[model samples]
Target chain A: MLIVDRVSKKFNVNGKEKIAVDNVSVKIKKGETVCIVGPNGAGKTTTVKICSGFVSPDSGNVYYDSISLLNRKKYLEKISVLFEGIRSINWALTPLENMEYLSGLRGIKKNKKDIEKYIEMFELGDYKNQQCNSLSRGNQQKVAIACCLCLETDAVFMDEPTLGLDMEISHKIIKILKTYAQTNKKIFVITTHDSDFIEEIADKVLIIEKGKIMFEGSCEEFKAVQNTNTFKEAYLKYRGVL
Target chain B: MKRVITVFLNELKYSFIILNRYRINWMFGLSNLFLSVLFLNLGIKSFGNYVTENVLDLKLTQMIIGLFVFIVIAEGLNNIISKITQAKQSGVLEQIIVNPLGSKYIFVIKFFADFVIVFISIAIIIPLTMIITSKIISFNIYKLIILLIPLLFCTLGVGLILGGATLVFKKLQSATHLMQFLILTLMVIPSYPITPYSFLPITVESMAINKVFSSQISLSFGLLAFLYAHSFAYFILGLLVYSKFEDYAKTKGILGHY
Candidate 1:
């Protein structure tokens, strides 16, 4: 379990201090896929980074199974993160090479069989031998996700994992995440705007706006709060589109 | 130790991959090196008599050693800043920093990789250079290498400072370029028999290198002791300052804002 307690982050831009993530807190349990749904600039990524310890929160503590993340080594060992829009793998390295590099950093002696399995499962074919730059955008994403998932951590935090992926690949990823989270009892915390994907995968939903959590509950309660039957309608309500 | 080795070997693999992927870039870079060595060699030979004349208060061999030593030193220093900026813009820096092994390991390993990649050129450039200068470069090769240790450590120390700045400041290319120019200028400055300016970062190391090759008894143990002390000093100072800046960047939430 991962616990975020009163996390807040502010950024200074052109002499103005902008609050990026307000005082927000959440408890994530194993086997639960929590989706933070919001429109752009909703501070979803900032909150995730703070929780993941990539960005330090001003006045909060993140505890990994009751241990403060100030013990970064233990905390990081238990979690893996896939930040949005970053080439998590170097462009010069092939998919498997990137996986090897990341695993080396994570201090994992990755088994060859597990690597081959993930590559095949993610449908990364001969492109695994090619540099990430040569892979299509969708395949690049798959490789990045595959690298993170290969870590076999207790928790995973992903930002916009399916942003550029085709529906087919996106569904494949969703299936993998569901199976992994269910069977392994792994915790997943994701932020995305894909309403249908979230509807299918999210055990709990958080509607974030302007750095504040507007609503937080089970998916059914989120839809009930908006008085909507469809996840898209509830998400549209959160985005102020409906 | 095992983790460091894994990081180092894997990062080294990536450097080879980069060299192969960016053929045109390496082509131009290698050509530039060849041209510079050619011109420097020809220019020195053309001025062999005047240079032997000790017109600049130094021997011709001293100039060659100074230039080559500067080349190696600059490569180590510049590698840090250049890669930081490149990784920042490519968004890889964020991912790298978030890793459990920490950013320090990654950058240091990458630095070793790049240094080795650059040294592959040195293997060719050195002999070609010695041939150009007519091989009057007889001295303690072992001593010369050992003496150059302080220069390497000092360069790494200062490189970390500037590299830390690059992490936060983002557009530090002009600053780094200016730093390179200043470094080259300082290389020659220490050649002047000045006493008071001995305290500058690389000044002592440069003078120590000159001392090692001159084959003279001015062999002050004082300079050698200073070399050891200052090497550790600059390295430690650089590490401390780098960590401070890194922590500040993380707090300000700009660690990823390329």
Candidate 2:
């Protein structure tokens, strides 16, 4: 299990104080997928980054099992995070080369098979050997996501994992995550705007806006908000977009 | 050790790939360095040179050798900032730091990889300079290396200080240039027995190198001991400064901003 307790973060952008994440607490048990959805500037990415140990929060702790995840090495080893943008992949190298170096660091030996599977699944076979920077934006994201998948970790955190992916590859990823989560009994905490995909995969959902959690409940309960049958409708109704 | 080797070997491979990709860069840089050395050597002739009252009593051949030593030190120290800045801007530093092998080892591994490149280039540059000037100055390779070793640690220290500042500010080009120039001036200052410039970071070490180069001393144990001690001091200081700045950046939540 992974637990985020009362985490809050603030930043100063151009001399103005801005709250990125405010008093947000979340918990995920084994074999569970939790999805966070919100509008732009909702602090979804910041919260996930904090959980991944890349960004530190102002006040709170993230715990794995019953112990505080204080050791960065131990925490990073246990989790695989889908890094966002160029921060995830080294543009100086190829997708395969990155997998080799990065996976080697993670002590994940012989990850070529895993890398090849994702390359084939995402139709990245043509771009695998090319430098990551030269690839298109969508393709670079694929490399980042593929690198994340090379780890056989206990928990996975991804932000906008399906963004920029084609529907075919996106659907394939859902199936892959579903099987991996089930067989490994892993914890997954992801944030994305894909309502239908969330409806399909997420056991629980968080609706957030302006650094606050507007709603938190099971997927079914989230869909049942305002008597809406679809998650899109529930989200629209709850966010006051209707 | 195993993880370090893995990272080091991979870094080597990438260096090779980059070298092969831009073969002209190597050729251009070498030719440019050769020209600069040649020009300096030739330019000195127009001055109607006179002999020195210094300790080494350097003739033209000796002067060439001494300048070449300066070049070697400069070559080694010059790349650390640019290489680190490149990695930082490209997000390579951020991505690699997260590796399970830990950030500290990765930094050292990358340093060794770059140091290897500098070593190879210097190896090539010396022969090319000697051939270009047609100056035959004999010195012990082992002795030269012994003296040169301390400068590596000293320069690594300087590199770390600059890298630390880079970790926070991100736009330190002017500061980096200022430091490079300062290092060059300090490194090449005329090291006479009476010059009194020995307090510079590499001054004593460079004097040792010149002594070995002109065959004035036979690889003295006292000098080597001094170097070994100072090398420890500079390297440790560098590590501390880098770590201090890294800690500050982490606290400010600004490590990966650039």
Candidate 3:
């Protein structure tokens, strides 16, 4: 289980104090896929950054099981993150080399079988040896996803994982993430605006706006909040559009 | 310890793979280094007979040693800052920062790997320079190595300081270039027994290399120990300052920002 307790962060923009994340808290159980949906500047990315220890919170702590994430080695060992809108992988390296090298950084020795499995799963066998920069954007996204998932950490935080992906690739990734979450008992906290992704993969949904969570519940309950069946309708009704 | 070694080797391998992929960049960088050395030699030769023969020869040797020291120290000091800046702009800095093995150690390993690559380039450049200039420069290989190892340690420490500043400051290219210029200027100052220049970074090492090559003075154990001590001190200081800057970056949530 992962718990984020009363986390808050403030940033200075244009020499003015701006609250990016404010007194937010969340708890996610193992094997659960939780999607955070919000408008622009809703503090979703900041929250993920804080939990991943890339950013420090001003007033809260994150924990895995019963251990505080202040312990960097344990925190890093248990979590992996994919930041939004960036080429996180080394552009100069082939996808296979990146997988091996990144996993090696965590002290995880991937066997040949594991390498082949990821290759087949991501359909990267054809492009595994190509430099990531040479691959198409969707393929590059797949490689980045594979590199992160290959770590197999207990908690995975991904921000906008399907940002530039096409419908076909996005669905494939959604299916892979759904199955991975189901079988591995890992906690996935993703921030996205993709309704299909949320409908297909999220077990629970968090609606955040203006640095505060407006709603938090199962998909069914979230839709029922507006007495609707479709996630789009429910979201629109909640935002006073329907 | 084993994990550290693995990270180091993996980083080294990754660097080599990248270097191989960008062979053109490698070639160009080598050409640049070679041209610098060649021009310096040619320029010195053009100044022949301007001074007494003995004085001219001594000045040439000193200048060559000074230039060589500048190159090595520049590599040691600027490599980390450049790596950090590149990583930051490319969005890979955060990934490395969140490594379970600790990002700082990974960078140090990266520096060591880069140093190895630089050393290889130096090996190639040395002979090429020697061949082209017909300058069979000679030095006590053992003493030179002894002097350089610690000097690299010190330069790397200073590099870490600049690298740490790059982390927080985010735009330090001009500052680093200025620093490189300052180091180049310092390289020209001859060693003195009790001068303030002796205490500046790399000054002693530069003089010591000149001493070994010219056979002017024998290096004592005390002096060698002092070099080691000075280098290690800067290295430790660099690590501490880097950690502090890293903390500030994390607090500011600017690790991924420009």
Evaluated with DockQ, which candidate comes out highest? 3
Best by TM-score: 3
Clash number for candidate 1: 0
The sequence of per-residue lDDT tens digits that candidate 2 reaches over residues A1-242 is: 89899989888889998998899988889889999899988899788877877677888889888656567777777787775544677776788887776676554554577778767755689988998879977677767766776666788888877887778667866776776677778888899999767977898898878778888888889776668888888888877897
Model 3 alpha-carbon drift over 4 Å, by segment: B139-141
lDDT leader: 3
Clashing pairs in 3: none
Instruction: List, residue by residue over B1-258, the lDDT tens digit for candidate 3.
Output: 888778777777877888888889999988998888878877877787576777667766766666677778888777888888988887678778888877777778888988888888877887777677666687668877898888888888888888988889977766676887778766657654637777777777777777667666688887888788878888898899998999899988888888
Candidate 1 structure quality by residue, lDDT tens digits, B1-258:
787787777777767777888878987877787678778767766776555455432455666667667777788888988887887777667667766777766776777778778778676666666676665666576776777777878887888888888877877766676776878766766533446666677877876676567543354667678777887798788888887878888898788777
Better of 2 and 3 by DockQ: 3
**The 10-residue segment with the lowest total lDDT in model 3 chain B:** B185-194
The candidates' DockQ values read 0.59, 0.41, 0.66
Alpha-carbon DockQ of candidate 1: 0.59
What lDDT would candidate 2 get against the real structure? 0.73
Model 1 chain B scores worst on lDDT over the 10 consecutive residues at B51-60
Docking class of 2: acceptable
Candidate 2 C-alpha error for residue B137, in Å: 4.1
